[model samples]
Target: MLKRICIILICFIALLANPLQAKDIIFYGGDKNSYNHQILHHALSYQQHTNYLVKTYTGYAPKQRAYLNLSNQEEIDVVFGGATIEREQLNHAIRIPLLKGLNGWRIPLVNKKNGNIFKNLSSTEEFKQLLAGQFHLWSDVVVLQSNNIRVHKATNVKGMYQMLHKGRFDYFPRSILEVWSDMERHKQLDIMVEQHTLIHYPSAYYFYVNYQDVRLIKDITSGLESAIKDGSFDKLFNQHYGEQINKVKQTLRKTYQLTNPHLPPKTPLSRKELWLDLNMHPTT
Candidate 1:
């Protein structure tokens, strides 16, 4: 009888310890190697502050069309992507810039033989003469086309790289954080980074929750804000991206600023503490 009582007591204690164990939050994104996976893991790790445990599932959806379809179909509870007005209309955004506007700073990926193609390029008009590659559904396509820059649209990212290699486009502009790793990963293509130019605009990457997931939205927003307030967010950012940020600072690249017409009105641009300024060295 005593053993039976002890078993019951132990089971009760276990239940008490994990009262919300059944509440699982699903974070879906591309494969483990993708930046989306890193952001999902970092963002979901903070869910200990709420009554949920996060389980990540990598989906087959490509970068261009992942967020809307995944969230709308209830296949994913959370996703990370570049924030735009249309995207916010489709889902709820956490509004904290994940990369702190660095997504807007683009460096070109060009064939090794033509590495100096942008060396003497001085104006946006001259830049416009070169055709660039962009994803068909990406906000960057709109931004580039609006600036009078000719863009060749591709549905898949890997295919875009292949097209650039085949000279279907003059250059492929990729984020500074992404360009180096892409070049290394696709080394067989013999692409090199263009050292002379930087394409600048205002862009933000944010965590988005499904439209009906109010509890999740609240938890994520609170957790992210807490992480920011305590400096853990900055610490994590530097831990992953310090090398790239430092590389950009050391390079004498000429920057050309462009207006991002797709920027949402509610972007937290005034939150100075939430962003990393490339001009001001960020502390790890």
Candidate 2:
């Protein structure tokens, strides 16, 4: 009995000393290879406690369905998206702009033939006259429309590229971080990243969890905050985007600033460290 009691005590002590078992978290939406996906992994690595094993769900879910899954905590443990009032109502947003507000800096993707159209722009009014192509469900659609810019909507990404190539829209404004990869994907379509125009607005992307998932909410928020403090967050961001930033700086582009009426009121826009500074650009 003494030997058995000693063995039991040893096992209990070992359990107490070991770190808590990492939670198996199923991330239901977002591409596993995308920048946002990489940032998610980086953030989770900084967890102070309650380690997480984030596995991407292979099956696809539309944005609305993903929102529903996260809200219900059914299968999906987390989802990332642009900060919108409606989405925040359904789930708890971590509120760190995953892209550091770079998503708002759009560079147009134009048919190679019409590339010259963007080479010269005199005024924001002329820029607004061009029809912009965007996914109908994207928050950018309303933002562009609210700013008096005409927009043509596509139902899907592939369709947006097709529409742009077919002249169904004047130009497709793609985020600076995304436009290069998107360019490679549709290389067969003869589209070119516009050389000299940058559209600016305020936008933020965030990871969201079920409102009831207070543990995950706390873990992600704290992890990201810690990463930011240790400078790891900026390091990771530069690793992924430094090349693109250099390219944007090689040539001066006409900066057309627009208003984002949809930007959440709670966005930490005042946090200088959390955003990329495009204010150095000379406005046309």
Candidate 3:
């Protein structure tokens, strides 16, 4: 009898030991606009792993929700695609950094003939001066305003491309992956563009868990760390983003007048600065 009781006790312990509770993680992020969202979708697609249910909001809601930790108050489990600093600051946010499984491709939309406007303005500051009182772009304008670079904000990529084609905005920024992902959407837009800064902004994405679901965060973090250890992170990143990386590098070589098309053997920029360069890929 005692032996049988012991067996039951062990079985019970085993069952309790497995803590993947019925708790579902509410993943909040942008409206599938980011590559991080796609990667999270693939990772959490399994039936057993289905507890990580996603809840998306348009625009900056995910960012807002994360900073606010809305899901935590409602007992939701996790939020995907927040920055490391964000995770660190949020009391409940765990730092399970994920590889965004993405590579950036910086493309410049410039006029067909006048490349001199871009000559002295390789960095953002110089470019801002040249663009003083010029065409507007929300993204570029935001960057400029932060650094005192004034410019106008265009409605959308298509509108901005039209501005560039008509010699309105001097040179605009875009992601090659974004353009390729929506090739059909942007196909007929006759914008002469060159993609540069190949292989910029390789980063580990993260699942920031609320403090309320500390145990759940631990589980997800473990899974992700395992993924990282065995190289699953890079595998996924390289698999999906690899082709785009290659394509961008090739295009940038022919398109933009970059000092170096490929990432150097040793980069001069610090980690933080390098990431900025990778993300911005300003023609230098």
Candidate 4:
């Protein structure tokens, strides 16, 4: 009993020394290797004085479950994903485009045998005629539908890939940041990235917190703004996506620029520096 008391006392003293830091800032729906996961910690690092304890959920949390957890503040503190007007109204969003609008640059995943099907795509109308696959809950679905593109909804990434491989959908448009990794992960499914086409729209991925968590909201927003101002945000972004960006710029592709009707009004459209100008892509 005496030894037990002594150990308990020591543990108490250690806890006193650390004071349990801030309420853990939990990220959901992604592992540490994901770009959003890296950026979350990176932005939060700018606010060391807050002493936030950053953690990621141990397994893949479905996007719906993550949002539910975030809404209840039960299991998640933040979620990173494409933004829409409804989402901004429901949560305390950091407003910084975590992907610098690169999430909007989409490349299609085609079955290997049909890889060259998009090579000569000449118009947005022609592109729209090809059926696309998207997770039903994603903002991308709405964007595609609003643009008159036909989309078949899938419940998960694996199923979507399977559907694409089996010809249930003509193509699955994945973000430029995601397609390479996805292609690598699902290589066994006989899918390939469409080589000669790119589809883009205006979109932003943001860190969102429950509306009641004002302190976290302020800290995250300030931290991201500080990171942006200091160039660390771009540095980190380039470190992860520089190769893809460079390749997309150099590639010869027919580009389709779509309009996102549901984009939140507060999106920093005026912040020219925060967005990549795909217009700079070579026409060749």
Model 3's C-alpha root-mean-square deviation from the true structure amounts to 7.4
Per the 3 Å backbone cut-off, how many clashing residue pairs does candidate 2 have?
0
Model 4: clashing residue pairs? none
**What lDDT score is found at residue 75 in candidate 2?**
85
Each model's C-alpha lDDT? 0.77, 0.84, 0.49, 0.82
Off by over 4 Å in 1: 1-22, 30-49, 58-75, 135-137, 154-168, 188-190, 279-284
Task: Report how far off residue 282 is in candidate 3 (Å).
Answer: 9.5
Model 4 score (lDDT): 0.82
Give one digit per residue, the lDDT tens place, for model 3 in 106-219.
455555565444544455445446442223522334434554545556656446656666777556555555646544455465454543323233333456656666556566
Tens digit of per-residue lDDT, candidate 4, span 165-193: 88898899988888989989998897898
Which of 2 and 4 is the better model by lDDT?
2
Where in model 4 is the C-alpha error above 4 Å? 1-23, 29-33, 58-62, 111-114, 135-138, 152-169, 185-191, 280-284
TM-score of 2: 0.84
Give the lowest summed-lDDT range of ten residues in model 2.
Answer: 275-284
- In the range 1-284, model 1's lDDT, one tens digit per residue, is 99999999999999788675346666665455555555555555666544565566655666546676656755677777788787888888889998888888888999877888888876767878899999998778989988889999999987987888888888898998899999898988967888877888788988878778787777777777777777877777787788898898887877766778899999988988766665321111
RMSD of each: 5.9, 4.3, 7.4, 7.6
